[model samples]
Target: MAGTLTVWKFDSPTGADTAITTLEDLQKQELITVLDAAVVSWPADKKKPKTHQLNNVTGAGALGGTFWGLLFGILFFIPLIGAAVGAAVGALTGAMTDVGIDNDFIAQVKDKVTPGTSALFVLTTDATIDRVHEEFRGQSAELISTNLSHEQESQLREVFAD
Candidate 1:
């Protein structure tokens, strides 16, 4: 089956952290197959968010470490790379574009996930969308997933720069 990359935004700093448990439980029920996952938790007092890769949960299908690093780097570290990384930033941007993660999506993620907020990025396949969606109901979670098509995700693995 084709895979999907999904991002969920939460109002509270620990909301995404809490949701991880739910996701794991859902996976156990066979409602979804989680390939990999990560969380960005930005506490109220912190200047930036903390990005954590859920290494333990990832199975044989883990997307390499560099993929996650580059993604979070683009999302949170571009400012630091603005002048320093120079042309490399252009290359990274180009690579991300190849995967359908365009500037608009990046800007939207930046706009919504801020300090005192959190986000969960999950790579999965065979998801029961409505059932998974219902699990988070009555919560402040917003599905801010780039919602990349399976084709886009396939392109991502092929084109992502090391």
Candidate 2:
């Protein structure tokens, strides 16, 4: 059997709304289970009463900023190796901010999500990755990253099957 893995990366929580709706529709057509939902939200608010249950999994700004820094450095320096070390160091400094965990930026972000910067990852593995991709052809969401192929998905499904 073959399977597919599609990562629907979104800038906001609602970005996956369409995908979720599509999943619901797909569920109507066939049996499907959500393998995982990655959400970046405020840690304290995530556990509060009356809060949405799914937003518990959170991402942090400082970490994301750091990631952006590192990515920017590598991407920028790729074509300009003459500036690699300088760019990398610059990226690291630009990531720091006042009033957060010092030297533990990632930990701080994990403990307290920064404002206005986060991501949600919806990982769906089904025998029908193509259909899912078709369902998400054009939308406002950005494809931040992805991993998987037909053969790999099949192997993964078997390894993680019910």
lDDT of 2 at 58: 19
* Candidate 2 per-residue lDDT over residues 5-78, each given as its tens digit: 23344444445554556656665666444444444432323432111213222122112333333332332233
- The deviation in Å at residue 29 for candidate 1 is 1.1
TM-score of 1: 0.90
Clashes of each: 0, 2
The Cα error of candidate 2 at residue 84, in Å, is 29
Candidate 1 residues lying further than 4 Å off, grouped into runs, are 159-162
Q: Candidates' lDDT values, in order?
A: 0.83, 0.40
